[model samples]
Target: MYLFRLAMASLANRRFTALLTVFAIALSVCLLLAVERVRTEARASFASTISGTDLIVGARSGSINLLLYSVFRIGNATNNIRWDSFEHFAHSPRVKWAIPMSLGDSHRGYRVMGTSAAYFEHYHYGRGQALQLAQGRAFASDPFEVVLGAEVADALKYRLGEQIVLAHGVATVSLVKHDDKPFTVVGILQRTGTPVDRTLHISLGGMQALHIDWKAGMPAQGAGRISAEQTRSMDLTPQAITAFMLGLNSKIATFTVQREINEFRGEPLLAILPGVALQELWSLMGTAEKALFVVSLFVVITGLIGMLTAILTSLNERRREMAILRSVGARPWHIASLLVLEAFALAFSGVLLGTLLLYAGIAGAQGYVQANYGLYLPLALPSRYEWTLLGAILAAALLMGCVPAWRAYRQSLADGLSIRL
Candidate 1:
């Protein structure tokens, strides 16, 4: 305890340099921890993007491609499955529930998804959590009503009862739009930290109504244009849809139902287990994630190296101090122990400051990140792994402190009572 107080007093005498070293280490530690937290949370978020569904059925395509378009909403589908084929499997005894998805429309930059009321009751994410409305109610029999995702509503400043037009394609700016058949926003879903938060949802009937007047890829001619009200009286059953998700009555029957959907004679359909597909997708991104972690680790090492340099550089100027202590009954080991204590002090202070900085950053940016990127960064306590990381950092600092400690011990022994300067 006496040695520790002596070491702290010595550091206080050089407080400017000591503070800089602590700040450097704190920044590096903060960065490393931040990267690790984001990597872990992102993986968890990715895996939980869609859950409680046994299989996802779509037109035959690469599993990654299908998963991308269906769950992540990343790209367009190669082909859409016939709605009748969806009905064929949806009615099977093995199937418990199905949610059809009709994509390929956009509101502003957000992709528009056409689904059924069943979607609200069936679709789930993040540990089987169902979608909740932040405002108003789901689109009920009205074919001209739409639902906005939390992100879409917040970014575009939309409210319930507001009229909005959907474009023909997924482009940010489309020359062709369903302006003549604008729909009223009936609801806005709560944020899910998934692709769903970036989507604009509408019933399948509303989807069909938006494109009902189109001929080929272009809008119908002036006389052929179908009014929104006129289409309300017409059959709005979707002809085809991008993809659909299914839940099985029995987990044991999952493979059986998947096989049946893939082998359906009605169309070339593909069915994949959501869990398996999510794993495959995460594997593809693992390399980049590891690279980021490595970069942050290197930054921490750089900061520690700076600390080692500072200590070694100060040893020359403090040689007289060491010699004086040696003459005044202090053992060489005491001098070495003092140096070790100083290093530990700097590292421990950095760890504390880094933790504070991390929490502060998370508290400040939590809402903005969730609103814009659909990633929820929680301000929870550090996990066991994070504690292990911090322990390793302090251990590494102790190991590094040994180098300067040895140098100071040799110098104090050699220059017993002599002042070089």
Candidate 2:
């Protein structure tokens, strides 16, 4: 305890250099921990993007491509499945529930998804959590009503009862729009930290009504144009959809259902287990994730090296101090122990400050990140693995401290009662 106080007092004497070292280490530690937390949470979010669904059925394509378009909304689908085919499997005894998805539209930059009320009740994410409305109610039988995702509403500053127009295509700056049939935002979903947060949802009837007046991929002109009110009286059932998700009555029947959907006579359909597909997609991204972690680790090592350099550099100037202590009944080992304690104190303080900085950053940016990137960064306590990482950092610091400690001890012994300078 005496040695610790002595070490701290010595550090206090060189507070400027000590503070810089601590700040450097704190920044590095904060960066490393931030990267790790994002990596873990991103993986969790990716895996939980779509849960409680047994099979995702879509037009035959690469599993990754299908998963990308269906769940992540990354790309366009090669083909659309007939709505009758969706009905065929939806009514099957093995299927518990099904949610049809009709994509390929966009509001501003956010993708527009056409689905049923069953979507709110059946679709789930993040540990089987159902979609909850943060404001207003879900779209009803009205073909002009739309539901906005958390990110979509927040980013676009939309409110319930406000009318918004959707583009005919999924482009950020779409030239063709369904301006004639403006939809009213009836609901806003809570943030889900998934692709869903970036989507604008509408009923299938609304989706069909938007295109009801179109002829051969082009909007009707003048006399042929159909207004939104006029389309309400027409049958607006969707003819096709990009994909659909299914929940099975029994987990054991998953493979059987997948096989049946893959071999369905109505169309060239593909069915995949959401969990397996998510894992496969995440595996492709593992290399990049590891690379980021390695980069953060190297940054921490650089910070530690800077600390080591600072300590070693100060040793020459403090040689006279060491010699005086040696002459005043301080053993060489006490000098070494003092250096060790100094290093430990610096590292411990850095770790603590870094943790605090991390939490502060999360608290400040949590809502913005979730609103913009659909990633929720929680300000929760560090995990066991994080504790292990901090421990490893301290251990590395201790190991590095030994080098300067040994050097100081040797110098103190050689310059007993004499100043080198």
Candidate 3:
């Protein structure tokens, strides 16, 4: 007990150095926990984005690329699936419903997705959950009505009845705008923490109406832009769509239906299972993930190295203190134990403090993240891997503490009653 008091007093004496060491360890702990949280949440978000949808059909391309473009909105599709292909798949006996997606436009930075009301009816995420509107209503009767994702509404500060113009193509700045045919925001969706939160939903006819006067990727030479009121007279039919999400009548016949769609002679298309495509994507990205983990490990090692150097540098000053304790009848083993205990206590406090900081950040940013990205930042209990990693960190700290403690023990024995500097 006396030796413990001596160790505590010793640490309290050099408050500045101890605080610095604690902070370094805390920062390393923060990095490790943050990386673990991000990696887990990223996989969770990806998995939840396409849940309950059995298959996705798109133009002929790599399954991973098609999934990345259609599901993640990360890339562009190479080709468009013809309208006839969508109809064929929709009417097939095995298919319950199909949601055709037309991309290539944006309102500000938000993506404009043209689809029917069927999208809000069938889309699911995060444990087979369905879409729910948070405010206003769906585009039931109004062709020009639009629905805003939580992110789009929050980021742009748009509300019901606000009118906005869609830009030509997906460029950040567009020379051509559909200012002539603006759409009204009639609905706002709840936060889902998926790409859906970042999307602008409009009717298929609205998309067609916007591009009516354009041909060959530009306005027709002799065509004058039509007014919003005059658009009612023009034919608004979509000729192509980027991709389609398919719901099957039965999960058992999913492969048979997929085969039918893939072998369809009416149009060229490919059907990919969302789970399989996501697996392929992760596999392709595995090298980068592994590299990141390796980097985090190196950071931890560098921190531990810093910790050791700090302890060794401070040992000289502590030697006189140790000699005083020895003169007061404290054993050499007791002195070594004090050094080890100090190291262990600093490491434990650092880890605990770091975890609290991480949770606080996640708690504060939870709403913003869900509203903007549709990712639910839950502050649940620590995962199994987190516990395991924490245990490993504690064990490593103990090992680091032992090195200095052992050296101090040897020196106390050699010096006996004499003081060594």
Q: How many steric overlaps are in each model, in order? A: 0, 0, 2
From the highest lDDT down, the ranking of the candidates is: 2, 1, 3
**Predicted candidate 1 versus true structure: per-residue lDDT over 141-242, tens digit per residue:** 989888888888888999999999889898888888888899899999998889998998999999999888888878998899999889999999999999
TM-score of each: 0.93, 0.93, 0.92
Residues 1-421, model 3: lDDT tens digits: 7666766777788788878887887878877887788778878888788788989999988898889778777678989988888998888888898998988888886788889889999999889899999998887655577899888898889999998888887766888777667889999999888898888888888887777778778865435776667776667778888999999989999899888878888877789999998888887776787788778867766776677777778877667766777788777788778878878777887788878888998999887776545567689878999899888888888889888888788776336445644
- The prediction achieving the highest lDDT against the true structure is 2
**Model 1 residue-pair collision total:** 0
Candidate 1 residues lying further than 4 Å off, grouped into runs, are 413-421
Predicted candidate 2, C-alpha RMSD: 2.1
Report the candidate with higher lDDT, 2 versus 3.
2
> Which sequence of candidate numbers ranks them by TM-score, best first?
2, 1, 3
Query: In order, what lDDT does every prediction score?
Result: 0.91, 0.91, 0.82
- Alpha-carbon runs more than 4 Å astray in model 2: 412-421
lDDT (Cα, 0-100) at 394 in candidate 3: 82
| Alpha-carbon shift of residue 30 in model 1 (angstroms) | 1.5
Per-residue lDDT of model 2, residues 1-421, tens digit only: 9999999999999999999999999999999999999999988889889889999999999999999989998899999999999999999999999999999999777899999989999999989899999999999989899988888888889998899989989888999988888999999999888998899999999999998988999998999999888999999989999999999999999999999999888889999998899889989999999999999999888888988999999998888789888878899899999999999899988888999999999999998887656678988889999999999999999999999999988884456456545
- Full-model lDDT, candidate 3: 0.82
